[model samples]
Target: MSAATLAAADSATMLRRYLLRMRRYPSLTVLLVGMPVLLLLLFVHVFGGTLGAGLPGGALPGADGRGRYLDFVTPALVVAAAIGAAQGTAISVAMDRTTGIVARFRTMAISPVSVLAGHVLGSVVQSVLAMGVLLVAAVALGYRPGAGFAGWVALAGFLVLLSLALTWLCLALGLLSDSVETASNLPMPLLLLPFLGSGFVPVESMPAGLRWFAAHQPATPVIETVRGLLDGRADAGTAATAVAWCAVLALAGWAWSLRLFRRTTTG
Candidate 1:
């Protein structure tokens, strides 16, 4: 069989299965669309002043302290949609395992690859919805964007890449985790890593050890690239670094998650 034909068959199967999952549970679809807006509001109104002070605007001098804090945080929160959206896959997978949905999928004739791809696609849909909602809110809050339409598109593209990449890691962990509770905790490290990184503050403000980690960490690259794009800075930015890290995570998690997923069902 030709490799091209095999790839085409696999893509078809993946899309079919993903659409089926959407039909099976529409409530999850709602949650995915809603959560990012919730997070954005919670940050902007409740924590906006405090958090805004930290962004381009706020109380900070030299920086666009006069800028809207919501604008600064919008990208990070958009990136954060990945965490929520990706976790949906983990939670759903764990539930599927407990209820025997995965076992049923295992018994099917189509390649098991659909199981992974469906979850990723579902998560991306959720992330996109959440980001869109948050963007509207950002604009309402007087957040004038520095980037034009192209820059905005770039921002969205980055989030999608990062979202899909980290999702596999979450999938691997969800498969290995014994319960839904445990799977939820898996994202905390990834989420907090950004805070420790340059996402919220400059790396220089942190301790030497932390500064070193934040300087080289994945989230830093991702956030810096995001900030640059969102603010429309001419800098080459951190997307290159983010792409490198995403590739590493995607490769590592795909291999590791597959091993763990197979074990969970077989054992």
Candidate 2:
């Protein structure tokens, strides 16, 4: 077989292994999937109406405060769910490293890239699945986005890119850690980023320093772009910016992860 074919085969095998392991556990995935749904429920039913009422008039067209709030918050929760899934990546990667699976792979004929690719693929898959469950729960809760077919396509593309970027970052963090606990904790800040961004509220609603930070952070542009797309007000510049951020992050994380993986497996 050609080199490309061999790599593909190895990656597929690794991917199946990762998926089967996840299926056996189920609990971690359940927690990863459920947290976002619970948060969505709490935010929409419990706090959404009040928060929506507090928004300036005309925040969203043709919708009441609660409805508008749901529209705004759903994407954030989706992103949050994706990030939450990264915690699983970090933990899984750390477990593999600590348990000597990675070392064993190094002594075998398996493709090196496949080792990382499998985990990254699994993480992204799980994240997307979690996002889907979150979306279903959101729709059941009366969260109606204004996006049409093309818009939904754009949203899916955006989500996939974001998941890839975040998953890689988590993997790198996992590889960098000395323990599974450390790896799991390293990505905890990601969960807090949505709150800091324009996720739950508009950037303008924050204090001056916070508002500036909120507007410029990676999450803001992505969230804004998602919000615009869903609300039928897509902006090309914002979309480009979001893509740029995801690309840069994915590249950085991929490079960092390779370095750490090599260091750990060979040393």
Candidate 3:
């Protein structure tokens, strides 16, 4: 068989393996898919309700209502939905690596390339499900899209891209980690940056210096870009900035994950 034919066969085989694994543990599906929706409810029903309306302006230039915590929280929820899965995916994937499942899979027709990507495919699916649940919950909680249908579509696309980028990063981390625990913990610092961004609170509300950093952070641009799309008022700068952030992270994470995978596999 030619190398191309062999490669195609390997990919198909790997995808089958992935589906079988997913079927065996449906709750992994629940955990990956349900957690984001739960967080959205927690924030909107509880925190957003009180805090959103209480904000100084009642609503800012981009958001629907500073008072409508649902609107305020939904944009952040999108980001949270994207990033939240990274930690869980990392820990789970790391366990697969440490236990020699990855090695075993590597020896099969499945290539190392397929092994890592298979895990990321799962994450991408989970992210989309989480987003759907969150979207319904947000709307139910009185979160209306001020931007309209096109805006909603853009927002959805952004979340998907963000999820892809993050899933790859987590995969890399999972590969490089000393253990599953480290893989899980490594993403927290990056995760927290979103909070400082326009997610839960406006960057302007944050302390001046911290605001500067927060405003410039990856999450900041993502949140802004997402919020703008959701509200139908996305700024070009914010959208461009968010796209740039995703690009940088995606490239870095993909290269690093591959390198780490090689080192781990060889060593």
lDDT agreement with native, every candidate? 0.73, 0.89, 0.76
Tell me which of candidates 2 and 3 scores higher on TM-score: 2
lDDT of 3 by residue, 95-207 (tens): 88879887786676545676777777777777777777777877876677887888877777888788888988888887778798898888878678778877887777888
Candidate 1 ranges beyond 4 A from true positions: 1-29, 54-67
TM-score of 2: 0.96
TM-score of 3: 0.89
Better of 1 and 2 by TM-score: 2
TM-score of each: 0.83, 0.96, 0.89
Candidate ordering by TM-score (highest first): 2, 3, 1
For candidate 1, the lDDT comes to: 0.73
Q: At residue 267, give the lDDT of candidate 3.
A: 77
Return the clash pairs for model 3, or none. Answer: 53-67, 59-66, 147-231, 147-232
Error of 2 at 127 (Å): 0.8
lDDT tens string, model 2, 62-104? 3366676787799899999999998899999999989988889
Model 1 deviation from the true structure expressed as Cα RMSD, one decimal place: 3.4
Scored by lDDT, the top model is 2
